[model samples]
Target chain A: MNQDKMGKGEQSRARLLQAAAVQFAAVGYHRTRVSDIVRQAGLTQAAFYLYFPSKESLYQELMDGFFQKLWELSDAGGKVTPLARHEVRDRMKENLLELFRFFARMPEQTRIVLTGAEEREELHRKLTSIVSANLRKNQEAGHVRPELSVEVAAESMLAVVQRLTVRFLLSGERTAEQLAEDAAALLAKGILQADRTKEE
Target chain B: MNQDKMGKGEQSRARLLQAAAVQFAAVGYHRTRVSDIVRQAGLTQAAFYLYFPSKESLYQELMDGFFQKLWELSDAGGKVTPLARHEVRDRMKENLLELFRFFARMPEQTRIVLTGAEEREELHRKLTSIVSANLRKNQEAGHVRPELSVEVAAESMLAVVQRLTVRFLLSGERTAEQLAEDAAALLAKGILQADRTKEE
Candidate 1:
């Protein structure tokens, strides 16, 4: 039964991934070994070798899955029809809340993603570029401020979300909803006093 | 003379640190070996051991130097007398510009600090806490918006600076002066439009 064997193989791969995520989160990528992953998954070395040729490949797979999900969410956010200037803030806040919720569901994966793995830098670049493009689009639409550099703004926003998610949301300090709301508010209004005169 | 020998020993130590920074920046902390450092420094294993007991200790010294410099700059900024409300933004920009200049002088060290090395996370936490304390002080003085959480704002600001520094400043795409001015503006006015009606 070829189909039956394929199903079993998929289950084995899933188990290995779960174990790898836990190990990588706890001890970090460089310190984690295939043996540790197999032991945690209650699988044999032979099984691991069947699924992943090397620990690096397994780590790549984990990172790939993480980025794939993130891109999917970003795509979904992008497809939302352009909203009124007043409504864009709410939509952006909701999208960010969803993104944080995704991170909350797998904080270990979040840790691995934020660990500055060399391979993942490519993903980071892609994500920032995508955010920059989106910001440029919003700027063209007169939704965002036109003076700021889209590239820098996107990078800054990514940095803000990443830092907050890793430091607060992962630690359970506040719910994703709260963080998203507050972050959105801060990004929307900034930290400066509204009535203050703009000075160089 | 004893003093002559001591000077030679100090010179050897400096050479080793310089070589180690190059190695760590090119490859990463995990892959780098003491042998490579010693060879790069044009020194012997015996000489390396005479100055530092191990590779870990050498790395620790590098990190210590980096953080000490950062703390000094932060302290200098903190000592600046509370400026007029309109002048605070310019002073903050000037302070950040100085910091970016510091990073520019040693991009290798910047890479090391941002590489998320396990030990360096402690330093990152300390930096964030210090920033948070300062934000709270400003908030109390009514210089900053009171609605935002000082802790989150501090973390976000650090994240923005870190990302921009690593991506742009390290690559020579923008000068510290330009980045500081733009980042200060964004943080002051935010990405949102100024005339928008407040909506949740």
Candidate 2:
């Protein structure tokens, strides 16, 4: 949303949301009040209510937007036609890099949503469904192991992504590309050395 | 820990702690009151105080115990001498199964600790350190791949275990052995099909 191009009402609403994100990220959702948000946004209480019915609704909208953005990213990456095992691995790496970049771009919101228990659960559920569907497709294409449970695989992958994103990327300890490379390699071939690959 | 061996004072303390776990797990730590916990245990506030100073201390003790148990499990599993890749995989599976059984046996405490944001963060930190150290030793023993980051690998593995434990084992949708099998397979070989092994 371009501040200069937005209408007056839209501009006010955007300001309010931006302020709320900062406030929520700093003190959390429960401690943040409407008055504080409005004051930070340089808007009146009436103006805040004009854009959002209640503080709860505004917070919900913020979460909804964040989740929606992540869903779109997951869906977009899954749209690639079924590929070979190596190609799938590459695609996973690319997708993970993109995700890490998104987290870096929105560190505060990412931390807020990922650290909150309920919000994290909701995000995980959505990511699992999308990732599970993609894995099923890959399994059908014979890229993934047939015996693997897509549910477990998806959840596990998301868990790894979440952990790495928070500890490595968000904390500035490692680059997204570096984390993505290691994560993709780990998920593709795992931690075992070369010898075990022959047993299968 | 055995109720049959406990004296009167020990029994009272155990009841209070049990009551607190139920209350905290049911309604969360912030909403639960000391009065409610004592009442549920059929004890008075003074009795509760005799064992613990305040609600915060009691909650902290429960969290500490839960984390300590998990740390010990991870540490014990890491004690096996370096072995063949297959043997290591077997050990991983067995360790995961044992961890799952522990979660199943203490479902309430598991849920309480896993669901709480602060508790979950602290537990993740402890588990990651223990697992990371184990991975480092395995790497030194020529088991894990040389290129892999033990930090990433350990955190990823713990994330998968946590996800599977909460989603499948705690929900009773899968047995401990079943989840351990899938988890170990995923962590050992990942989801990729067999052909990619040659690329490495």
Candidate 3:
């Protein structure tokens, strides 16, 4: 993983991706050109072409990289086995913290994805499916309520995650740890207090 | 509200709005032309200009209308008073049902907003603030958990509402009543069953 160990081509490709993410986030996708990317990367147009066919393709690659990392994290929660109350909240906080940290690590890519990814309905649906599957697994393991709609739950969870990422994490109003703790607690027990509104 | 009761100018404006929604949702904003909208409305280009200065303006109006209705519904949730458990869920259901019904009643605007509204960060924040204010009111009223972050909860609630509207309601996969019912129960009690994962 050492930079010195990278092959010339690999290094050039890495430079291109980093440059593209920065330029795209700064100037936006439409304004950021292939020339801007290459100049920023200190490479020629020919070198850029070797790595990507077009500016759009390079942008897509950056987006795919962000989502790919996220997809990997989606599975990092592992099996949601029944756990002590505190342990359950801790596990949720850990998973959410990882997501916020990913955003922190790749701010540029996250910015690009936030602006452009909504149009890609397929991406939204796929992520929802992955989260839904995880919830389904939890349900079967008795960690989640059996009668709950997993699809709805997954979609709702993603909604909350996306909102918090954009509002709190991105804005620096809260740390990844603080945001995760608050979100995990709210999500675990929900907003309701015990038997306060329990049916008559 | 009767179309036959409308005056000539009012009729022309309504026709233009309807035509623009259909065209915008069909071919997207970029590909859709003023001429196409005018033709669909069976009106002259002159009449279209009299109603809207440009295609973009017309599209904005439609989007505004949708969000305006949603903002009204945001207020309609009203003060959260201590109520029977079933009444709490029913109130949530009624509020959510109003939202789904709004989407159902304005499918074209919903489609356009779904595709484009994410770019409007102000709109998202405003809606979240409104929802958060409602949650804050609930917390003050002793219905919601006082420790819960109302801001995060509001953002999460809006997220879930948006997702369900787009996925299940828009696609006709679920009815408004069903969606509202499921969402209410989930929001009220959350997904974790009582004492299942309680601390040792």
Candidate 3 per-residue lDDT, tens place, A1-200, comes to 66699999999999998998898777678888888989999999999999888887887777877778888887654544554333555677788889888987888877666655533466677778888887777667656666678888777777777778877887789888887877777666542123232331
Alpha-carbon local distance difference test for all models: 0.78, 0.79, 0.74
- Residue pairs of candidate 1 with colliding backbone atoms: none
Per-model TM values vs. the true structure: 0.77, 0.80, 0.79
Runs in model 1 lying further than 4 Å from the true structure? A1-17, A27-66, A76-81, A116-119, A190-200, B1-17, B28-35, B42-65, B75-81, B116-118, B190-200
Chain A TM-scores of all predicted models = 0.80, 0.79, 0.76
Best-first order by DockQ:
2, 3, 1
lDDT of 2 by residue, A1-200 (tens): 67889899999998999899888887888888999999999999999989999999998888787777888888754654455444555676788788888888888688887765446666778788988897787777666677888888888888898889888888899998899888888786642223333322
Off by over 4 Å in 3: A1-15, A26-31, A42-68, A81-89, A190-200, B1-14, B26-32, B46-68, B81-87, B117-119, B190-200
Model 1, B1-200: lDDT tens digits are 34365678788998898899989987888889999999999999999999998999999898787888987765543543365565666677788889889999988888777754644677778888787777777776656667778788888878898899988998999999888876877775542123233321
Task: Give the winner by lDDT: 1 or 3.
Answer: 1
User: What is candidate 3's TM-score against the reference?
Assistant: 0.79
Which candidate has the highest lDDT of all?
Answer: 2
Q: What's the ranking of the predictions by TM-score, best on top?
A: 2, 3, 1
Residue B121 in candidate 1, Cα distance off native in Å: 0.8
| Total clashes for model 3 | 0
Candidate 1: TM of chain A? 0.80
